[model samples]
Structures are given as C-alpha cells and as structure tokens.
Target: MCRWLAYSGEPLRASAVLLDATHSLVAQSLDSPMGAETVNGDGFGVGWYPEGAVAGSIPAVFHSVEPAWNDENVRELSRSIESPLFFSHVRAAAGPPIQRTNCHPFRWENWLFMHNGFLAEFAKVKRDLTFAIDPSLYPHVTGTTDSEVLFHLAITHGLADDPVAALTAAVDQVERVGRDQGVLFPMQGTIAVTDGATIWALRYSSQGRSRTLFHSRDVPTIREMYPEAERLSQFGDHAQLVVSEPLNDLPGLFIEVPESTIAILDREGYHHEPFRSAA
Candidate 1:
C-alpha cells in the first residue's frame, strides 16, 4: 500500500500540505502511523495544475525513484509551486517495481489520479483486466501498476463525464474479472481523482475492509476549534484535503471516510455518500 493526499481550494504553495503540515506527506512517507505500510520509501510523485490553467490543461507531474524525504527535487518543487489543486503520493510497492512510470498521481488530459492499496493476486487477472480496457486508451497506459490500470479503466468507463459512475462501473468489471480468474478478493484500495476544479475520493475493498481515508473538516470549524494553531491562517476558506491519514493529531479536524463510501469536495463543501456497488 501507499500514502496519498489531494488538496483543493485557494491557491497556496503545495508545501502547505506536503511540507508545512505537522505530519506532512514527507513525514508520513517515513513514519506513517495509520498506513498499511510504515515506510513508504519505494518512490514518490506530485502532480499539480499550474496557475491560469484552463479546463483542459494537463497538470504537471514530478516523479522520482528516491524516497520523498531524501529527494531534493521534491523539496524544491513543493516549496516553489502554488496551485489550487494538486496531489502527492509516497509509495511502498506491494507488487509493481519502483520506477517513475509506476508512481502515483497518474495524469491524463485534465485529470489526475492516485490510489492506495492493491488488486489481490493481480497477476492472475492481469491479462483479462488489461484486455478489457478501451482499445484507444490502451496505448496511453504507460505504466505497469494496478493503480494506473484502474485509472485507465475508469476513463474507459467515462470518468471524464461522470467520475463516480465511471469508477463504480470500473470496479465492478475488476471484481468480475478477478472472480473469473478464481481470485477470492478482486479489488482493494482508496482512490482520489480530480480535474483541478472538483475532487472525488472513494474508499472500498472487495473483502469488506479498506485502508484509512480521511478528509479535513471545514477549515472554519477547525480554525475555531484550534485558534492557537498559527499555521491554519495560511489556507483560504475553501481549502480542503483528503488524505490517507490525518496530517495532524487534532481530534476534530479530520473525519474518516467510511468504508464503501465516496467523499466529494467542491466549492460548496465536503459531503459523503455510501458507495453503490455496480456489481
């Protein structure tokens, strides 16, 4: 499994979440208290939309094989760029080799996607699953990770038009293919995807248990609850984050996204709905 987080709302330096937070992404990479793996040092990546991006602009991605804490480029980029939407992930390989292409925050057009967890016995269903992807999208899937494959599957199912429905359909196909291959549990993981305007996060597992997923409570609520925390001032009212683990120990600041649920974050606020199984 891996650790990841997505940020949306007012434009601020990516470091606000990747570095400045008490238990930042870099900190989580080294010692995650809630992840499936404690050390997510296999590799890391960050994707962010640049300022003035239009609807179809693809976010820039920076991936490296080095551990997040040790990578100077990650440090430099995080501290330099300011974006309203971005994604950061630190990986602990479950099966795929640690390489740049296999890093999280995979991008396609205006979308950015990342996942934490693995497809149970992926090798058993790889052929069947890969062949199910849209023929046109097959050429665009440049990586060899189940997470990246899942992204293309979602796109193939229409993520560009309706993310929730498309992802649900994609998961159903994965589970069906897994069962056909005799695998007991077909899919597992939490997924986060965004279009630089809205964000959607899902927590689910075929076996009925999934990795941790949490989103920050409304910033104003948190500010009122912990007025002494000076760092909270840096974020705008709409700023929000959905992470694999809480960025800090604050009790009321983050809420766990329930298993088999989808959490949506937009200009209005964060709301969650039970995930419907397409299978």
Candidate 2:
C-alpha cells in the first residue's frame, strides 16, 4: 500500500500540505496512523502543474528512490514550488523493487495518475494485462509495478475522453483477468488522476472493502467553524484536497470518501458518484 494527496484550488506552496500540516504527507510517509503500513519509505514522487500555466500544460514531476522524510531534495522542492494543482505520493513497495520509475504520480502527456492500492497476484496476470494495453501506450510502460500498468490501462480504455468510464473499464479488465487466473480478490486500492484542471479520485476493491480516502471540507465552511484558526486562512474558498487520509484530526476538516465511490473535484467543488467495476 501507499499514501497520496492531491491538491486543487488556490496557488499555494506545495509545502503547505506536504510538510506544514499536523499530519502532512511527509509525516504520513513516516507515521501514517490510517495507512495499511505505518512506514511508506520505499520511494516517493511529486507532480504539479505550474501556477499560471496555460490549460492542458504538462505538469512537472520529481521522483526519487530515497525515503521521502530522509530526502533533502523533497524538502527543498516542496518548499520552493507552488502550484494550483499538484500530487504527492509516498510508496511502500509490496512486491516491486524500489526504484525511481516505480514511484507514484506517473505522467503521460498532460495527465498525471497515482494509486494507493495493488492488483492481487499481479505476477499471474501481468502478462495478460500488459498485452492488453494499446501498443502505442505499451511503449511507455517503463515500470513493472501494477500501478503503472493500471494507469496505462485506463488510458487505453479512454481516460482522456471519459475518466470515470475509463477507470471502471480498466478495473473490470483487471478483475476479469485476475479471476480467470483463480485470484478471488483481484484489485484493491484508491486512485487519483488529474489533467491540470480537474481531479478524479476513486475508492474501490474487488471484495467491497476499500482503503481509506478523504477530501477536505470546503475552505469557507472550515473558516466559519474555526474563526480563529490561523491555518484556515491560507486557503481560498475553492481550495480542496483529496488524500489517502485526513491531514489532521480537526473535526470537520475532512470528509471520508465512501467505499466504491468516485470523487470528482473541479471548479464547482467536490462531487461524488457511485463507482463499481463494469464487469
């Protein structure tokens, strides 16, 4: 399992959420109270669309094989860069080797994708899944992790045209392939994808129990609740976050995303819909 956070809204330093929060993404990397593994030190990555960039611009990514908390560069980069939309992920290698390529926030063209789950018995169905990817995308499958394969599969299934539908189809394919190989629970995890303007997050599992996922309460509502909390002043009304877990314990600061649901965050704010495999 892994832990990740996606931020969309105001242009703020990545460090505001990555390092400055009470239970920041970096903090989660070392001591995640809600993650399956308390320590997710296998590797880490961050991707962000530059503030003021034109629409559809490709986001920048920084990846490392070092544990996030131990990496000086992660600290420097997060503190220096500010983005209106960004993604940060800390990895806990389940079976894949620790390497830069295996880190989350995988990018293709102008879209970025990350996942906090795994495909069960990946080795058994890896070949089938790999062959299923459109050949044009198969060339970009640089990493061996099931997460990367899942991203490309979504693209092959039409992520650019319709993310929710594409994701559902991709999961269906994974479950169908895994069950064919005799694996009962074929998939499990939460996922987030963005194209610099909007973010789409999904929480689902083949067995019905998915990993924890959350999104921040709207900034205006939080400010009204904690009138004197200085921290709430940093974000604008539209600011929102979808994370693997709540960044802090503050009541009403975050809302848990229901299981088998897809949370879509855009200019209008957060909207959720039922999400299940098409199979």
Candidate 3:
C-alpha cells in the first residue's frame, strides 16, 4: 500500500499540503493512521506542472527511494516550487523492490499517476495484463510494479481522452485476467491521476472493500465550519485536495469519497460519480 494526494486550484507551495498541514504527507509517511501500512518508507515522488506553463507541458518530477520524512530534497523542493496542480506520493511496496524506478507519481506526457494498492496474486496475471497493453505504450513502462503497469494499461485504453472510462476499463481488464487465473478478489486500491489541470481519483476493489480516500470540502465551507482554525486562513478560496486519508483531523474539512466511486477535481470544483467496469 501507499499514501498520496492530488491538489488542484490556486498555485501555492507544494509544501502547503506535502509538509505544512497538521498531518501532512510527510507526517503520514512516518505515521499514517489510516493507510494500510503505517510506515510508507519504500520510496516517494512529486510531480507538478510549472506555473504559467502551456497546455500539454509535462510536469517536473522528483523521485527518491529515501523515506519522505528524511528526504531534504523533497522538503526543499516542496517549499521552493508552486503549481496549481500537483501530485505527491509515499509508497509502501507490496512486492516491487524499493528504488527510484519503482517510485510512485509516474508520468507520461502531461499526465501524472500514482496508486496505493495491489493486484492480488499479480504473478498469476502479470503476463496477461502486460501483454494486453498497446504495443506503442509497452516500451514506456520502466518500472516493475503493478502500479506502473496499471498506468500504462489506462493509457492504452485512452486515459488521455477519457480518464474515468479508461481507468474503469483498465480495472475491468485486471480483474478479468485475475479471475481467469483463479485469483479471488483480484483488485484492491485507491488511484490518483492528473493531466496538469483536472484530477481523477478512484476508490474500488473487486470485493467492494477499497482503501480510504477523501477530498477537502470547498474553501468557503471549510472556513465557515472552522472559523477559528488558523490553518484555514492559509488556503485560498480555490484550494482543494484529494488524499488517501484526511490531512488533518479537523471535522468537516475533508469528505470521504464513497466506495466504488471516481472523484473528479478541477478549477470548476469537485464531483464524484459511481465507478463501473467496462468489461
């Protein structure tokens, strides 16, 4: 398992969510109360679109196998850079070796992706899933984790055009392959992806018990709900976050994304729709 967050709206220091929150991603990396694993020390990565960049520009990436809490580079970069959209992930490797190549927040073109779960009995279906990816995208998969494979799978199915539909199709294929190989409850996970503008997150499992996920309530609502909380003052009206768990314990600040749901967050705001497999 792993923990990750996606932010959209208002260009601000990445550290606002990655390092400065009450229970920030760095804090979660060390003591995650809601993640499947408490210590996600395997590796970490951050991907963010540069300010004022044109459409289709690939995000800047920083990856390290060091624990997020101990990584000075992560802290420095988070404080120095600001972007309207970005992703941060601290991984707990289920099987893949801990290495920069196996880090989360994988990128392709203008898109960034990360996952916090596994393909049950992946070895049984790895071949089927690997071969299913479109040949053109196959060569671009550089890591050996199911997460990276899933990203490419989504790309093969048209993630760049329709992220929700493509991810649904990708999950459907993984489950179908796992079932074919006799693995029960084949998929389990929460996923976050962005194209430097809009963010799409999913919480689902074949058995209907997905990992935890939540998105912040709108800034205006949060300010009114926690008027005395000083942290609320730091965020702009457009600030929004979708995470594997709540960044802070402040009541009503974050809304739990329903199981089997796909959440979408953009400049317009956030909404969720029921997720269904294409297969």
Candidate 3 C-alpha lDDT tens digits along 190-256: 9999888889999999998999999999999988888898877778899999998898878788899
**Candidate that scores best on TM-score:** 2
Reference-based TM-score of each model: 0.98, 0.99, 0.98
How far residue 37's Cα lies from its native spot in candidate 3, in Å, is 0.9
lDDT of 1 at 52: 81
For each candidate, what is the lDDT? 0.91, 0.94, 0.91
Deviation (Å) of 80 in candidate 3: 0.7
lDDT for model 2, please.
0.94
- Provide the RMSD of all predictions against the true structure, rounded to 1 decimal: 0.9, 0.7, 1.0
In angstroms, how far off is 107's CA in candidate 2? 0.1
How are the candidates ranked when ordered by TM-score, highest leading? 2, 1, 3
Candidate 2: minimum summed lDDT over ten consecutive residues — where? 245-254
On residues 126-168, what C-alpha lDDT tens digit does candidate 1 reach at each position? Answer: 8888898999999988889999889999999999999999999
Model 3 Cα shift for residue 153 (angstroms) = 0.6
Candidate 3 residue-wise lDDT at 225: 85
